[model samples]
Target chain A: MKDTTAHIVEVCPRDGLQNERRVVATEDKIALIHRLIAAGARRIEATGFVHPGRVPQMADAEAVLAGIGPHPGVALIGLVLNRRGVERAVATGALDEVNYVVPLTDSFGKANQGQTTAESLAALPVVRSMAADAGLRTTVTVAVAYGCPYEGDVPVARLREAVRAIADTGPDEVAVADTIGCAVPADVTSRLRAVREVCALPLRTHFHQTRLTALGNVHAAMLEGVTVHDASAGGIGGCPFAPGAGGNAATEDLAWLLHRGGHTTGVDVDAVTRAGRWICDVLGVPPRSAMAHAGPFPTSHPPRGPG
Target chain B: MKDTTAHIVEVCPRDGLQNERRVVATEDKIALIHRLIAAGARRIEATGFVHPGRVPQMADAEAVLAGIGPHPGVALIGLVLNRRGVERAVATGALDEVNYVVPLTDSFGKANQGQTTAESLAALPVVRSMAADAGLRTTVTVAVAYGCPYEGDVPVARLREAVRAIADTGPDEVAVADTIGCAVPADVTSRLRAVREVCALPLRTHFHQTRLTALGNVHAAMLEGVTVHDASAGGIGGCPFAPGAGGNAATEDLAWLLHRGGHTTGVDVDAVTRAGRWICDVLGVPPRSAMAHAGPFPTSHPPRGPG
Candidate 1:
């Protein structure tokens, strides 16, 4: 089998927990991170630096980050929207990278960040500058690159234009997000190919399993040479703004698929599944992951020999 | 975009209902079939002709099939495990094809049908002959083609040999089944390619969503030029024998993915989702389909123009 290795960035704490109506305790949040690291997750999006009034679920961002130990080789990341958010993330002293979003459509961009698409793009340089000055790595997530809940299907030309604008900021990586989980394989293939044309930086994908095509979309993008992905444990979290949007692709499912497809994700599916079950238990919701429900492939009892 | 069209065989009625503990009324089953047809499903597995005692959920198969109107261009298929099942299916006068299962593993075969793998293969010729005499189409599904519940991983060479044997019997179509939902893309690719090398007949696939790799595996198989697939509405149906097996790939999800991938499945996703939701209500179970849960892509709420 060919080597199909990729980097996986776990976004459960930030993107996953942010949408929960019930706030996860800071200690539980820290435990989830520990569980993730134990599952071989080297990169994790720890929390969002948004206003607590807007998303109280992530209000314990600073406290949660403070509780985590400085594990070497683990890229603890935080999501930020603007300069002030960047400053708040840097103040946490727990984030190795600061992530930001720039939706391709003005309606979604404005609704999400109180800025138009052009304004969001224009603010990227400042956000990057601040994060860089803080000695933090950076990644810009192009939200709704596949489709906009408000604007409907986005054109490839618009995505190419957005990718060019975001790439110009010289961030370490750029991620195309399916905020509403509306994208299918062809959409992923066409849009990712278009984004790859203008952006030379490493590309990442954030997919929602709302329409049950996230895994397929991930495979489609992987075939187009994309490796880095943002997935949540137990397939938790949906877009709070996008109606009917489901959770992100489960980290364990992604790891299982990637590993079975000859890709080296360096993540243990069983360990992730354990943590996934734990988080879902914490939230009082069923884990929506198929892997979590079905167990691993070739599932068997320990000690293969019969009695 | 390349036209990646595939023939989708909806197995909701037969496969989906068979495992349900609660036996749905015959009228409701007929209603589900009508809804599937309204959604543009031309090929549908109506019910299994297995012994009523063995699968009481399908005990009213004859009544359900008898109630369905024989619409033009629609092929109503029935599942059969033995020669007696072939006889019963032929007597139904409502089926266009008689489908049989010949699991690749003897343990599973014997456990499922009280016959070894070789015995099941030996019975295929007689079943095909009986179905052909009745002017009915024939399909032999090689269950556990991906992996066995008892035997674990099945080798590619074994699949190739089994496909060769099944093809030699000259069934109209041969289906490679992931009975336990254990197959990944590489497994689908390698095994399907191997099966393709031996069988000249049209191919089909039956996948379980156990590990959430079903959609991804379908995409992989589609890329390998294998189109025909077996999917259930609302992602219903789990293997009664395979422990921890998830449901089949949901029909609405498959149609959504295929249509978005530029394939003409000719199925209305919204209509299928409506039926999917209805059937789940009848079963008193939550719809396992993401499409049913998330709604269709480009979800609209009417009035495109601003008031």
Candidate 2:
């Protein structure tokens, strides 16, 4: 039987593109989202409804959201950091899910949102209530869940305390973001174990390739039973703190790692690699995904279907 | 009982310095070896006894070999490619082990050694016999065992056939080299399994970080009963295929992966990461190993010990 066990969310269109210096014309962002969904992503984080003054790249997020075709089984997600972003995202009526991000480290939260971690936590309840009132699936993504950049490392106690505070918001899922990519496999497994103790909800993992252990960290998380993963086409994504730090684990590379580990990622490796190589030309940087230029497994050399 | 299981062979002195265009001083190579042995590497690939005219990088290999300080238990290994290389290596009286490399793919062998795969294979038995007669431990390292840059995906049939041919030579062990970073976890497990069926000797797997699957591949190999791993200090080695293609798997990263997997790697992750960062600066490149920047586990601004 074809497995339908997990969901892979391709976040390149939104998270990946938001950091670029060159504007990717709203048309390209729209094109990227549609392509990711067609390529087997059940969920795509389409855009963030942040203030244009803060993220001008996402100013036209509504247009990108408008461009998506009505995919019957797929979900469109939009990110929001505060109540205003949520209200704006709710106005679009395009997002099935709205993710609320609250970084765990005070230094990171202050830099990212100009507030302390406690202040972000205080806002989560109202934001979660608003999304729930709008019948939206609420997910709270804790930035630097495994560790942090400015703060060095976020302790399990610090993360668990944030999880407890956010748990009061009644979100459906909690995603641990390795914003600075400082996590090793041990860090991933230990933090996931600690969080699983307090929160009984589904867990998701997001990793960056800064230290090359992103995929391995994902594997360690999956071994502990994580059901959803966050990735970008061509591994394109960035942190506001570490500019030009390669892409979020490429959707194709993540798919390859999962499939090789005997899990069904359901994303085509060749098609994704080709798309990554194509987008590198668009972005003018080599992909952070290792498998992109390394070529596909020869046996997996995508049969052209007898044409 | 404390685990006595993890074994890693440091190859920086040989693999790290082999392809460099700028000639590093002989004293530096010797100092590097002194540090690695002091840091607990039981085996080290010290130098290559190749023709000086062809690989200018190794012109002082003999002199470097002569300057080595004593390590009571450390086994010094030298890389060899043919009967002549083996003859020259055994003459050193410095090598406790000689790794006879046979390029698995014909294209790479020709590019690397100006010989066809068949010629390299035909030469293995003679070298193995000579090493056996001289009472030196001979390790048959099949270069590009996982994938070849010149020749795309190398078949398991090719690797197994090569192993069987070399096994007949009665060498002490066999190692599979990921010449390019083309190997993945599934390949490591599946291909190593096929070889396990044909040969019962210990298996040593070496990998490159070219594609970021290096550590993942190593974890899979260890799961399949591989006891020995080959890694370079500071993740400082690479192939001349091109810059950014990737170098050898960084020593610290591999140790971290294995240690976190509940297996022993017997190397210090902090020391190795520091070495990786230092050596990267020495070579003027970002570390080839991922964990160099990603510090140790549970590593958040913990109390620095009197630093």
Candidate 3:
């Protein structure tokens, strides 16, 4: 038997490409989603339904979803910001899950969704009911769960209250997101522990690699019994609202870390790397994943025979 | 009271620069070492005394040492490969410590030092005694302690025997090194445990980030009660003999991880980044450290005011 297993959500096609400067072709996005599934990614955030003017890169969401072939045992998720976005995701008829964001701070909520935090909280149950009626599993992510760009050092009380509010909405899983990559491992440990105290739902962690602490924080979260994580291929993805924030934790790097730490992800490292390199080639950007540049481990070199 | 503390040896000036294609000016090398000291690096590997023809990048060892201004608490170390190299280090009178490598495989030994593993082991005590008589501290690193290029997956018993041999010389510390960055956290845990059983010397870990497991391995070492770690500024340095190996663990990244985990390493993150960026500028390469690219955490941004 494998040591222990965890669920990893490859967010490359949706979260990763949403923030990129170049708009990838619809065919390329579908290809990436397929590759991610082939690499043992059972769940993927395939696309986001936002305004084209807002995120032109994700404007081809419907066409991309149409091109993606359903794979057995894989959940293709589409991100929705409001009721209209939820309708768009449901209309696609391709997504198995619809993910929504619950911005913890009012400033972030107004900036991102043009609604107040209280309003968004009130709307959570409605969105969940709609998605549930559509026969789609729903996930709600608490953005800036650790600290906020608009409000530095979000108090534990505020985060607990937010988790408690989201918990009442009855989402399948609530993601504690570091939207700006500002969290350290200790912060992750304490914050996730706090979330666990108030939340009965399965926990998911979304970390950004802006400060190079994403992997370290992932290790901490694993220690805290967080089995679900969000990562991107080639380390792509950043919050358009969070200034100077870098990419999500690279999928290949996270998979390698998890495997090395005696946890089973069932993700193929080589397949993930190949997908990462391919996407980088598409975007004309360097592959940000360290494993991509460093090549495979136990590099095949013939040992010098008996000397 | 502070949390746990770990000692990190900045090896940029020696191990990092030794592999650079461009030879840094002696003044620049001295400046970089000074910057490291200012960043709370109490122990630094300042230079390597190898044949100038073999490693032209380190040809200015004497000039570089002469240019360094002493910091009160710093221990400047010089790396030497042979007895003659030891003499050269002692003659410089700048290094507080002389570090030697005891290769565990004959293939690596012959390729690196032009000597067999047995010959290097026999010469270890002689070099230590010479450094001891010269009133300099000594450290012997068991290179390829985890895995080797010429011989893949070095047996733990071979490592135990090598450590036992080095232990007999009574060196201050023995670094269990992953010369090719091939180690996983389990490998580090088991191998370090094996080395501890055979050698009572304080253990140090030298890891290359070629496979992106260095920080994870560092966390494992800390759990095993091994506190000393070797890192480089901007993640520079790769073993010339170890093909496909990347740079050493980036010093800034290690310091950030340690600090975030509530461990103290007196090194200032900004100062280390400054040194890292400066060296990268000199080398005409992009800074390899992720933190360097991400900039400092708690990034200052004005909050969107209440509407």
Candidate 4:
């Protein structure tokens, strides 16, 4: 099998918890991060620096970071939307990287972060500079890059222009997000191709499993030469600002898909599934992942005759 | 965009309900078939002609066929296990096609149909002859073509041998089924390529979403030029004989993926989503489809600001 080793950025702590109606205890959030680390997650989005009133589930960002002290080898990431958010992340002294969000459309930009698209674009370089000055690796994630809930079908020309603007910000990496999970494989292929035309930075993809096309989209991205992808443990996530958004691609499921496709994600599927089930238990919600329920393939139990 | 017109074989009435704990009413099963036809499904697996004692959910197969009567542009398919099932289906006078199963592994063959792999292969030609004499089209479906719950992964060489045997049976079409849903894109690509090298017959694919790799596998098959695929409305399905099997690839989700990929499946996404929801209501189970809850993209609703 050809080696197609991939990197999975665990985002359960930030994007996964941000949409839950019930807030997770700070200790449990820390425990989830610990569990994900034990499952071989080297890069994890630990928490977001958004307003508590807007996303209550992520209100304990500082406390959770304080609870999870320092760990060698693992890169902790903090999500931020603006300059103030970047400052908060830098103050925590916990995150090694800070991911800044830049919505592709004005509607989502206003609803999600109270900024216009152009305003967010203008803040991108400032946010990157602030994080870089603070010794934090920077990644700019273009939110709603596939299709916006309010402004449907973002054109390739628009995405190319946005990628050009984002690339100019000099971020360490760029991630295109399917905020509403409306993109299919063709969309992923076309959009990623367009993004690559204008930007040569390392590409990452974040997809929601709302329409059950996330895995297919991931496969398309891999075929397009993208190696880094984002997934939430147990597939627990949704966009609080995007109406009807669903969970991110489950980390365990994505690991299984990649491993079966001859890609080494370095993430243990069984441990991630346990963590997914554990977090789902913490939130009092059923897991949205198939691997959480189906168990891994190649069982040792002998086959039985039909009952 | 490539003109990849695909054929969707809606299997809700047969494979979808067969594993349900609560047996669906015959009238409701017929109603589902009608609704699927209304949603532009030209090919449908209406029901199975199997031992009622073995699969009680399909006990009302004859009644369902009687209720449906006839439709002008639809081709109703009936799933069968052995020569006896072919006879029963031929006597119904309702089925346009008979799908006979040939398990790739002996353990699954015995558990599912009380026969060994060799015995099933021996009976395939006889079953095909019986169905052909009755003027019914034939489709030989190799069960667990991807992986078997009892025998783990089915080797490509084994699949090639089985497809050659199945081809000798002179069936109109061949369907390789991931009954245990253990296949990823690479598995689908390699296995289908192996089958194609041995057989020149038109190929189809049947996949369960047990591990959520069904859509990805479908996309892989489409890339391999196998245009006919199987899916169930509401994604309601599992194999009672196959331990830990989940639902089939959902019709609405499959349609959404294919339509977005620029392939014409001729299946209406909204109508199929409504039908999926309706069937889930009757089955007293939440829909296993994403489109059922997220609704179709490109919504008419205007964007709203954060509350």
Candidate 5:
């Protein structure tokens, strides 16, 4: 299990900068995506197609995507919330995939996308069909799949029902998101187990470092055969709707953890650390990544087996 | 495994404050211990018996222990580095246990205590005997057991050999310390397995959260049947000798992880979080604990499953 390869989906450009008070320059967002790609991130959440008034940080999504241009073997992902978001994302022809969020609880669903859980479920097929018709990939992310800030714990049975509904929509994959970062390793194992029982879609996990269990959750998920995980450079970003939520699991940190655990992430931990530091500098915030500050293991010397 | 009970040995006063640049007042240290006790810490590393000039923060070890006095159910632990430390700790008559440090590498052992790995190993039996004769419990902590900043990776065979030697000394329990915080979950699993092969003694683990893998390592250790773990309040603590080592795993954060995983820790997460915040305030540093800032999982309303 430890020797298997894992895929990291970089979310610094979209989810990482979404809730920042200061909107970053579109060029910088493009630069961050380029850096992430250079650091071996094949799948990147480039931007989001949401209300500009609601999330000003991602207002220049189209321009930012335009600035990134194209790269072979790299998949650009755009986050979509509703019908308008889906339309905006498909109209741009820049993204390889569109990620639609379906909140598990009504409170977060309404707060995040002005829709109820059932409404989001109803919109899934339409969202998937729109991207599918446009020759783009589609992934449905169940938001707050572990626990919700507003509605507390989302039961495993509810999650199973949600995943069953999502599987019916026929998206390319399913993602379970710890939107409020309130999950432990046990939660990851049980919830992923439940989701797997209901759907055969390739599973991805998105965790936040809110309670400092992100890496633990990632490890547990990996043990359960979850190969794809979401992380942000510098551990930046939080949901504006979820109070007290911290940054996402850091890219460099997760890469370091995976690499050290004998899992190949194909990520240059040093390069990702530099990119994390660079993006944090642009945001005028200290990097929330431990690898950014401490560097990779055996910082100064190459590791030598005991003498 | 998730349904078991775990023991947390609070190390905020000794390891937590020992590395701070500013020396905290002895009364404040006692108050911090009292707060931890009130927060349901049964075992506490109250202070270290080392040279005053070397670790100025722990200069008032006797004073701090004297002030803490006696509590029937709580076991006070004093960290000892050598024969002098052991003698000093026993003389104080306040400590119920004396934890001896034995570095896995000569570089760290020399840098930390002016002794080589062999020298520390040679002194362990004597140290253990001195404490045992004084009616004090003995625990041997192998420092840098995972990876060393100065000496890089400490091989598992080397760890097994060291544990074998320490086991011959007949300490009450053996501890593996990731002194530099370079360990991942696999490292914890592998190292603990190696140590268990050599010794039938009870096992404990100490992890630092420098690269944010501490909680994952803790979870891995728990799965390996290690019920005893060390943590510091507010995630305060690092080795002064370790160049880039960060704080120990935060007590409140660890408690939250254990409790959420259905493990009983006999800790009040909210109280420990408050204590963590209070100590950080005293040190004029921000609390490194996630729970200190984000509160617990169900931060607001009581958890209503699926509703």
Candidate 6:
């Protein structure tokens, strides 16, 4: 088997908690971030600086960021919706990166960012400069790069243009976000290939399990030479706009996949699974991750033979 | 853009209905096979001719086979567990090919076929001759090809040896079945590569969506040069003994994927989704396919607005 190196970015703290209508206490967020860093998440999307009035679940974002330890090797990232979001994110010295999302389709863009795709992308340059001045890297994510929930499939030529536009801005990475989980393996391979043709920047994929095909998309991208995969801690993600959209690919499952597929994920599946269990407590619901349901890897008590 | 072709085999009437726990009306089974055949199913596993005492599900196998309408493009196949199963299937005169399963793990074999892996495999040669004498091409399937529920991960060498032994009997096609849906894209790729090293026969894959990774495995295998895939309609299949295992990869979703990924599946995805709705009526659950829930192709629906 050929060796494929893979990286998993933990997004539970952000994507997982972002959609929860119920408010989460700051202490729990702090403890969760600490536990994630301990579980081998080098780059964690710590939180978003969205308006508290809009996302009450994330009302204590600043407090949550202040509470986390600045451990070495664990670079923290924060999601910024626009210039104001970036301004707040830059104020957090703990943040090493600020992620700005630009949608491939104008409708999805407007639905997600409350602006046209062009307007949202136009803000990228400003956010990049602010992030640069703050000594933080910028990553431009092309939301629904593979397919759109409202607009359907985005043409490859258009997506290439999207990647080129973002890559030209000279961000650290250009990612394709499967916001509604509409991507298949071919979409993953071909889209990655298309983006790679225009730019040399590393590609990150954010896949949702809406259609239960995101992990497959991850495998396809990895084959096409992508290394970074974005997953929530317990397969937690959903569009506030798209009601039935499923959760993002679970980090524990993705880590297990990369490790079991002979790729070095440098993640302990058990630790991630534990994180999934803990966060599920915060949500007060059963986790959406299949891996979390299967029990931890190398189950503590060995199978006493099959039932 | 290059045209990458992925082979899809329809398993609706067999894998789809086998676990119904209630015998489907003979006419309904026949209608499904006809529709699946019309949907560009070149190879369809129509039924399993096993003892009615055990699988009372196969009780109407002969009647269903007799009801199949003429379709030149369709190749109807039957799944046979043993020689008696083979004899009953051959008597149907409706099958163009036969698939014989030899599970890799002892527990899965007993649970699936009521015999140990060794005992089941020992009957392969006899079943091989029986099919050959009936002028039917036989495809050998090794269930739990990727990972077994009872056993964690079977060594690749063990898989290779099993395939080689089955190949020695001169089966036309040798397929590895991810019976319990434990296969990832990478595992599918490497294991298929290993099997290719030892056997020069046509390769096929059967996948279940237990962990929702089956379609990714299909895409990875197709990239690794596998054209044929097995899927159940409405995402149905589970071992009587292997509890918690999911159904086969949803045929409708796989067809939707191939069509979206720019492959020729000859099946109308919307029509397949309708069939999924039909099966869900029988199962009293919504179709498990994500695309089924997402609705038909983006193009099929009309004018919401321009993006």
Candidate 2, pairs of clashing residues: A211-B290, A235-A247, A235-A250, B234-B276
Ranking by lDDT: 5, 4, 1, 3, 6, 2
Against the true structure, candidate 1 reaches a TM-score of: 0.96
Question: What TM-score would chain B receive for each of the candidates shown?
Answer: 0.96, 0.91, 0.96, 0.97, 0.97, 0.94
> Which residues of candidate 3, in runs, are more than 4 Å off?
A301-307, B300-307
Q: How big is the positional error of residue A177 in model 3, measured in Å on the Cα after superposition?
A: 2.0
RMSD of each: 2.3, 5.2, 2.7, 1.7, 2.4, 2.8
- Docking quality band of candidate 6, CAPRI definitions: acceptable
What DockQ, between 0 and 1, does each candidate earn? Answer: 0.51, 0.24, 0.44, 0.60, 0.48, 0.39
Model 6 ranges off by over 4 Å: A242-244, A295-307, B1-5, B38-40, B67-72, B114-118, B296-299, B302-307
TM-score of chain B of 3: 0.96
By lDDT, the better pick of 3 and 4 is: 4
Which candidate achieves the best lDDT against the true structure?
5
What is the per-residue lDDT of model 1 for residues A1-307, given as tens digits with 9 covering 90 to 100? 4686777899998888888887888999999999999999999999988888878887888899999998999999999889889999999888899999898888787667777789888889999998999899899999988888777878889989988988988999999999989888778888888887898999999999888788878888888889899999999998676666789999999898888788899998999989989999999999988777777776656213221
DockQ for the candidate 3 complex? 0.44
TM-score of chain A, predicted model 2, versus the true chain A, to 2 decimals? 0.93
Worst 10 residues of 5 chain A by lDDT: A298-307
- Candidate 1 per-residue lDDT, tens place, B1-307, comes to 5796788899999888878888898999999999999998999999988888878888888888899987999999999999989888999888899999998888787667777788998888999999999999999999989888888888888889988999999999999999989888778888888988999899899999888878878888888888999999999998676666788999998888888788999888889888888998999999998787666677676213111
Task: State how far residue B166 of model 2 sits from its true place (Å).
Answer: 4.7
TM-score of each: 0.96, 0.82, 0.92, 0.97, 0.97, 0.92
Q: Which candidate do you rate higher for DockQ, 1 or 4?
A: 4
Checking candidate 6 for backbone clashes, the offending pairs are B7-B227, B237-B247
* Model 5 clashes, total count: 0
lDDT of candidate 1 at residue A86, scale 0 to 100: 94
Instruction: Give the true-structure RMSD of model 6.
Output: 2.8
- Looking only at chain B, model 4 earns a TM-score of 0.97
lDDT of each: 0.87, 0.76, 0.85, 0.90, 0.91, 0.80
After TM-score superposition, the amount by which residue B172's alpha carbon in candidate 4 deviates from its true location, in angstroms, is 1.2
Candidate with better TM-score, 3 vs 4 = 4
